[model samples]
Target: MSERVTPSAEAARALRDIERRRGQARAADQESRWVGVVFGVAIFAELAAPDFFGDGVRSWIGLAVAVLGCVYVVMLRTPRGGALLGRPTRLRKDELSPRFVWLARLAILAVMLIGPFGLRFLPQAPFPYTRTVVGAVLGATLIIFGRTLQRALTSLALRRDDKDGLGGATYGSR
Candidate 1:
């Protein structure tokens, strides 16, 4: 029989397939990051309530948009690890918390609880107080988010640690 060029002989075709898969994975990762960023921006936007268009409700509109954006993005990216029965992606618990993150977060929150009161008596009047309150709320929100993620990541990291004895240490990989 005459020698024929099988699919394996086509480097371009193989490369195309690999590229397509890579693109898909990248898209999924991007979707996940977008969900996080959009949600964060939404919370802050709603809280800030900027005077855009002089309409007090525009910030709420931005918040609504952010919610929709997050929902759409989440629909696109399948979760990496969960109770689902599939060809095992990331293990259910393969994450860890950074050093002193929890403590620093707590300290920020403690100061915030005390800062608003301190700001009111400042020589500059309500300006510093207003900014301090807003900053504190935003910082508190961020800390809460970080803690929740840390718990999830820690569970995953512990699982990996116990499985492979990998020493279970990571720094802000999330």
Candidate 2:
């Protein structure tokens, strides 16, 4: 004879599964903190290259950074790459609010534009360290803000899942 499961038991099982999946997702998000650090260091290296390297070497460094960036982007599109990077290969529209997305983009753009331009107007320091200073600041900002933004996005995604009655179990299923 086979045992029959009650509806309540099935629902309880689903809830537990959903919670487990959410926990996993959160862990992955935390693990992705390294992504920001890596990117920040790359930015710092790219900008500070001129300070420490000759023209020929700086160009090679720039090329290397560009190639690595391209590789990272291409990898982001693949399942294995996404898993390796601790990021989702695809994000559902409901997981991110368009307004917030736009705001974030605009803020980043403003910072990018303002930083160098603002630095240009400042009196020359004893050493020609403008690029180095800018690079360090921008790199640090990226590392700090990237983690905060990721957390906020994760929270938004989780809230959306709860609101949609999915409980995060259906995340990335589509």
Candidate 3:
């Protein structure tokens, strides 16, 4: 009798693949905000529009952010994304701080959803109907996140350098 590969293993493999994709997606997500900034700027010159149109833009941004957030969380939870983001070869174990990462991502996800809605209806904030708030929030988050990710990656490189005694290790003391 031959032992076949179990369905769970296949599922696990699939999840791993998804996780890898999510990491790529996260890096890409940083880009998404930049794109949104450009788009927002392009539309900023507009002096007039229907109120309902603003609502549509908010809804769209919220949905997009939620979708991306869902993807990110799914991958992070999976073995593959975790492996890539936390792999010793890619990032130092200390640098991948699950606590900070989860908090930052959750903040992004919340902002992505809430910010857009605020743009639509938050009366106290300027540009409440401009739909630019989402882009601004996203861009700011990306700026911070990009740095954090880079630092995380650097921590790993630093560890490798330390191991090699390269006399050039300068990270991961924070």
Best by lDDT: 2
TM-score of each: 0.30, 0.64, 0.32
lDDT of each: 0.47, 0.72, 0.47
lDDT (10s digit) by residue, model 2, range 15-57: 8887787666565554377778888998898888877784566
What does the lDDT read for residue 104 in candidate 3?
68
lDDT of 3: 0.47
Q: Distance from true position, residue 94, model 3, in Å? A: 11
On residues 97-128, what C-alpha lDDT tens digit does candidate 1 reach at each position?
A: 33345665788999988887876777763553
Clashes of 2: 0
Which runs in model 1 stand beyond 4 Å of their true positions?
Answer: 1-33, 50-90, 93-157, 164-174
Tell me each candidate's RMSD, in Å, in order: 11.8, 4.4, 15.0
Position 112, candidate 3: lDDT: 90
Candidate 3 weakest ten by summed lDDT: 165-174
Query: Pick by TM-score: which candidate is best?
Result: 2
Between candidates 2 and 3, which one is better according to TM-score?
A: 2
For each of the candidates, give the backbone clash count.
7, 0, 1
